[model samples]
Target: MNRDKDIYVLLTDTGTVLTKIIRTFTKDPLNHASIAFDEDLNEVYSFGRKNPSNPFFAGFVRENVRGEFFEESMCALYRCKVSQSAYSGIRAQIQHFEQYSDLYKYNLAGMLGVVLNIEWEREYAYFCSQFVATIFKRSGVSLVDKSPLLVTPGDFQTTPHLELIYHGKLHDYTGCEVTAAAAGGSFRTA
Candidate 1:
């Protein structure tokens, strides 16, 4: 029998100038979106800035949510239940992106399309929400009833399929044991 597995969608507002600008256009608290394979959010992926200090250089990234970048981020965690096969497909899709990460580029123009309510498709290019939506689409899972190109981080919250599990400072999240480490490691020096 095929059982269901839970996948996570993390929406965050990092307070960066770019996110601030996005929030203005989106009118939402969280403007960035990421997908996590586990409840602890240890394995998270997104099409976002590869370097914390540089927003221009971006693409597929295996996000370190526990790292300093997300320490003070305001975020919402959502859970989506999928069949075992769909979970495997999602895993495969993420793994494929990880393997060819260098070939991908951030879809800057697509962001404009999102703001203009148009669909923009580019080869091997994706913005955060597009990437997350594509993952579900390619995995044969229906996340939202809309085009991936036009999906916004706030759009995920409106979907009935996703359950909001937590909403607060990313570091203060105590939904799992990982929060203890996140809370403790904040002020510690390496």
Candidate 2:
């Protein structure tokens, strides 16, 4: 699909959103980790690096709302388009069905299944927001009006006016920073 259209597809997929969050760390020189939390501030999944190539690979360390945590391997790769470099192309999408969908049925096991399946494109920020919104919606938390969330780049500068959606409502959870990196992937709880 075209890059723009490919992003639209990602915005619509529940799994792709979660994957984007996980994949954000892949762009960094450090193995940065991400922590996914529930409404009650409980840990969900910890996606981080398993080994160190040089202590710079980004790692994922996430725990469930129930306080469960684990490690997994993650990588970032891109596809090519006719007019774009393969490194900057849009490829297949990803989803976290087992993480969000199965959360109601299973515990970390279900989350792990979903964590094992995060994916996204190389340089799309707007689509990344949609992905984040999808995860919040699927996780069963409603968004409050005017909620604030943070999306940071490699330099740690926050994107202005990024919309925050939660459980179908708009909420302000601004302290959270979503970083898009390049390298290994994982989740972690803080």
Query: Which predicted model would earn the best lDDT?
Result: 1
Summarize candidate 2's per-residue lDDT along 1-190 as a digit string, tens digits.
Answer: 6541111100111123334554454343212222232223233232222232222222222322121111222221111112223212222112333334222221222223333443332222212222333333333322212121222121111222122122110011111223222121222221
Question: Each prediction's TM-score against the native?
Answer: 0.90, 0.20
Candidate 1, after superposition: displacement of residue 33 in Å?
0.5
Candidate 1 lDDT, 84-153, residue by residue in tens: 9899999999989999999999999999999999999999999999999999988888788999999999
List the candidate 1 regions with Cα displacement exceeding 4 Å: 174-190
Residue 126 lDDT in model 1? 97
